[model samples]
Target chain A: MSRHRLTVVISQAAGKHPVKRALEEALVAALIMESGLDVSVIPSLYDLSPDHTGRLFLESVHGDMVVLSWLFPRAAFWLLDRDGIKGHLGETLLKPAADDDDDDGEPEAPRGIGAVDVPERHIYCIDLRDAATHDPFIDEVRRIAAECRTRREEKDRAASKPMMVELGTSLTANGTNGTNGVIGEHAATMPTFTAEQLLQAPGRRWYPVIDYSRCTNCMECIDFCLFGVYGVDGLERIAVENQDNCKRGCPACSRVCPEQAIMFPDYKTPAIAGAPVGAIGSLKIDLTRLFGGEAKDAVAQAVAERDRELVADGRDAVGMSVGIAKRQADKPQGPKDDLDNLMDALDSMDL
Target chain B: MGSVSEPLTFMMGKYPAVLPAELRYARNHMWCRAADGRARFGFSSYAVRLMQDVYFLDWQVNVGDVLEVKQSIGHIETSKAQSDLFAPIAGKLAVINEELLKDPSAINVDNHGTGWLFDMEHAEGGDAGTMSVQEYYQFLEANWENTQRILKGQI
Candidate 1:
């Protein structure tokens, strides 16, 4: 059996609602335990200061998985961004408070509406309003746990480390223009991206690249990429560090580049290599059937026939494509539907 | 009483709290003002500046509910953590900025105006004990200095 260790950290300043807090903590524990993962809940009285919180985050990163709860101040996000901590986790889960509607004087129960995407990780900002209904959060957590367990066992049995892809660059700081001198100064100063923005894709722009010739050994980028992307090599050369974790559009390093050597490549080419492939391969299904000339006329004829049939039956073609696709696909199971379900399941998890 | 013109040594070196005159502030960084009987309130610009990248705002209270002073009214989640919003004074909630529930970044855009969290009707004479604009300014000045000291390891 693969041993999965999960750690949960709650904010010290989450008020004195011990009962609510305990219930939330217990629910999280139960969800993990149900997945057969060994879980530990560590309660600390440390204030959520950036420096202090960053230290706690670094400690928790070593676990097989981690969950953070409680009322985290917006300032903590700036610290995390500066440290590039978001790039390290598989999931950064958030449970929004249930009584949030009470604060707004709204009578309706709050809903889960926020999500944030980091490179390989997904951050779910769940509304604690739904905490009473553990089904939504726990169901999601179980699926992720199952997937994680499978991946971990496969890697462990093979005795192979996860391949790290070097993105080939580093983030260097341009001189402080007397403006916000940091990478995510907007987040720190304006709270621009938070749980609300989580539901929408938070903007990820500018991938960092490094020029070794102009690079001095000054360790500023190393301190900034908190994602552990920059590190010293055997010869002590400040080289391209942890490139695998770099987000597709993170230009944070370029903004900080003192030598202006970092460059961001446009990634709009929608290459199929990054897409998922089925067992039989060959683009899974014939695109010609959907978009080829002969198929187009056939499809049009079929649509007209289906529409007439629907009109005659006093029904619509809403279920026609689904029924036909199910028949043509043999198994009648659509990968798109499965993938959507999987993404939803992953989003709902409390991990 | 000290002698006339004699400077009394009464912690003169301590910083005084100072807040912007036009801005209303709460103990938790929310700002409010009374227009007629209803009060308009929102997160201060200073608070928005401190909390960058706001992702969610969980406002649970609604119109007609009576809120007590200093009670947790709502919370704003940023990329990193969630911060609670506290009521500045006891009053009946009148309206909330519903736009923020969907787009919390509006607070960062114009914290003092469009980002206003909610509105309330102050209890009659409730403004009596509240700090004047000048006094609140002093309070912020002193508080900011103390925070700086704590950051500097002076506390």
Candidate 2:
């Protein structure tokens, strides 16, 4: 039998995030029920900070497979982009860092530099937001578990040393992994950084700050944001609750706010540059697509014109410039019968 | 039934992804171009860019099967998330992109061209009633903000 040892890191308190807890439990159940292997789930809390989780990931080996699970895409975005930890993994997973507003002027060194064993182990990000219903995510977990088992079997035959270091301390408080899987905790002796310190650190300036004067308490930002970036204060007004939870290079909340009340001090919005000839009109259409406006033509014409410009500029064009494509449907001709047929088809497919 | 072939161009914010005018769009972000009543479909460039790395594309329907508007015809499993591919219009299934079976990355690399999902013989007088590119563009603008929030786990 293949033994699959899985490690899941939670960035927030379980009491605060019932969804992540539910997902973690659901995954544990599915792994046990689906794979039928000796599956172990190790859970840890990192508060979405680099020093916390990065140290934990590097310090010990838990099992054959390690999943750096996060509840939000922003966490994955931070892990891959702003945290500057991808260098430790031997890959440049993010683009340039000019996009974020870093507080410290100096460049920071990569966390877990000499500690990460990239070739011997692998780490993948699984956003747990849809872990319960998204079969693909579940399928991916099973696939990874199988791969981990295969790799472990191969390594065992090659006389390789044991990958997991036995847990010395009690971690039953964290969670259960088949009743025996070891859940690792941060080393107590390791100094912990507060949220304030993290905010002041280099490459960590992606949090939002609200301007009270222009603020309308419409509560859209509060409802739209899932990372706890916005919370109602004692006065019952929206305030920046957990700044550390904000993902770098993401100015989404501010963009969504109708009052334009939310602002990010750390991110510099890229300037829209002037385009020549037909490019200006195309840019207008793009803006309409982004901000909302009635355009004279559909997205296709704008795309084709843009492609033509790219081809003229010796760049790769996006659309098929040669084919005589069909025009789009302008109005809804009615869908009652189609919808009923679809419902029936769905019933047959059992999806 | 407006001018579907009107030559035009547009951009979505600062992102370089282009939404083609000739293709009718579904809210799920797939686009369809119909010819001889047979509609060919694919993911919009903007949708492809958001998906980033696509590892798998599995079709649930087969050739000769009839599908309805909004019915899931396939699933796209990307590096970040899994999304259902819905039909842009009610139609009879015609062909699936065989090349995509070998190289799924083509969906991300050539989304507007060879990365098309499949084709369907659109049912007569049973118009799928999809959005025109301009209307879809407007819809994207109206929803882009919230969609970004949703993707980031803010909503």
Candidate 3:
């Protein structure tokens, strides 16, 4: 029996995502028991930082076969493409195809590895779609193993010089360089405010958050957004491109998102407070909540300053408080995190 | 482990609980039990708990297909997450749990019994040492401790 060492790369964020952990545990166990191959599971958490993807690239180059699960597929491919492996591997894998002998009706070998025009000889994509009955995947892995063995044999026989396939200018023209890089006019245009700058503005509290757990990369959110709020990342995943342009309290694109991966944190809260918490003239009550003070004069002074700010500039806050009153009246809180809702829906079913 | 339905619980906390001692175990926390020369597989109670709120099961492998140990035969999905279900041993798939497919929460509620995922004939290659009941318990205990350490930021 030939021993095959494969790396399974899992993508996670910095914060602990239970889903990613579960998938990693289950996948590692399965590979060890069923595939009977030497396997190492590598986690490439996206937020790991200043060198998040660089680490993944270094680790990925050592694997004979790389299995990308969950969010890793896009990031892995992007990394390989960025490092110029996509072109070289594409040429190498495609070279064998030109002299192909198999005229039989076997499924054509998978193409488009590493985000470029590369054959997927060494890459395997596993996601929710492949969660059930992955016999086909196992078969593909065996095929990759055979392919690698043949490559090794040929390399040993010839001791040939490595070929560097230059990715032509056409690839850049085709916007295949990096998915995150903006194409055409938007490349030069900067957003109105950075997320950090926007964070300082208090009234502007609502924007879409991507639930990586459920996003399917369908790109409906990308297509539906009029403002440049969403952009396709290097991995072809929809990302919040410009947090500033996303109209505060407006969830129009979110409603169109097929996966319902978009969410706003304070969806239940009205974007702008409606004339205070309690009775109209209860100044002392409002003051305590605002200034965290018991002194009557201090509390009253804080309330006056706050009310002035709300009356003068809060209504016009450009970041996220812009059209919230109208949005609140027109549309209900648009699609909160639907995971729990989906569970609820399922739990209520008779089955 | 009593019957398919009655699994044994060894709660370290709210999670990482339950195991069926009679069944052989996979590191993935799936279990395989041999009965009448056929191997029955299902998520161990601990695994089901980890999955949390499983709402759907997609059985991909059909009956009569030759199975390799650890090959994914199906997936169970919670609202927010989906995980592939792997076969525990090599065999020919003989039966699938159709009832459980319609009601996937059963895998959470009664993972050992009616929620049994699939059955295979002629399972192969698993040894008593790595896959037996006691070994699985040990694995669970270690995993629980590791999880505790992680929670405490010891890692």
Interface RMSD of each: 25.7, 16.0, 24.2
Task: Please provide, for model 2 over A1-351, each residue's C-alpha lDDT reduced to its tens digit, 9 standing for 90 to 100.
Answer: 334454433332234356566666666666666532333333322233445434334334334333434422223323332332331221113222222333322222322112222335555455454334435556765666566567667877786554444444643243333444533222211233333432232332446655343466767666655456778766676767777776554565665454444555333221111011111211111111221112223234434444555566577765534322232345356656432443343333211
DockQ list for all candidates: 0.01, 0.02, 0.01
Once model 1 is optimally superposed onto the true structure by TM-score, how far is the C-alpha of residue A229 displaced, in angstroms?
44
- Tens-place lDDT digits, model 1, residues A168-232: 24323222222223322111121112222222222222233343323455565565444566777
Residue-wise C-alpha lDDT for candidate 1, range B60-104, written one tens digit per residue? 677788988765566556643344555677878888888988777
* Greater-TM-score candidate between 1 and 2: 2
- Once superposed on the true structure, which residue ranges of model 2 sit more than 4 Å away at CA? A1-351, B1-13, B125-127
**CA RMSD, predictions in order:** 26.8, 21.2, 24.4
Q: For model 2, how does the per-residue alpha-carbon lDDT over B1-155 read when each residue is reduced to its tens digit?
A: 45667633435457666776777776667778778777787888767766667877778889899987666566666664555566666778899899997788888878889898888887863236667888777776766654554443310
Q: Which ten residues in a row have the lowest lDDT in candidate 2 chain A?
A: A270-279
* Candidate rank order under DockQ: 2, 3, 1
DockQ of 1: 0.01
Off by more than 4 A, model 3: A1-351, B1-8, B14-16, B125-130, B148-155
Please name the candidate that would achieve the greatest DockQ relative to the true structure.
2
Q: How should the candidates be ordered by lDDT, best one leading? A: 2, 3, 1
Best by lDDT: 2
Model 3 whole-model lDDT (C-alpha atoms): 0.47
DockQ for the candidate 3 complex? 0.01
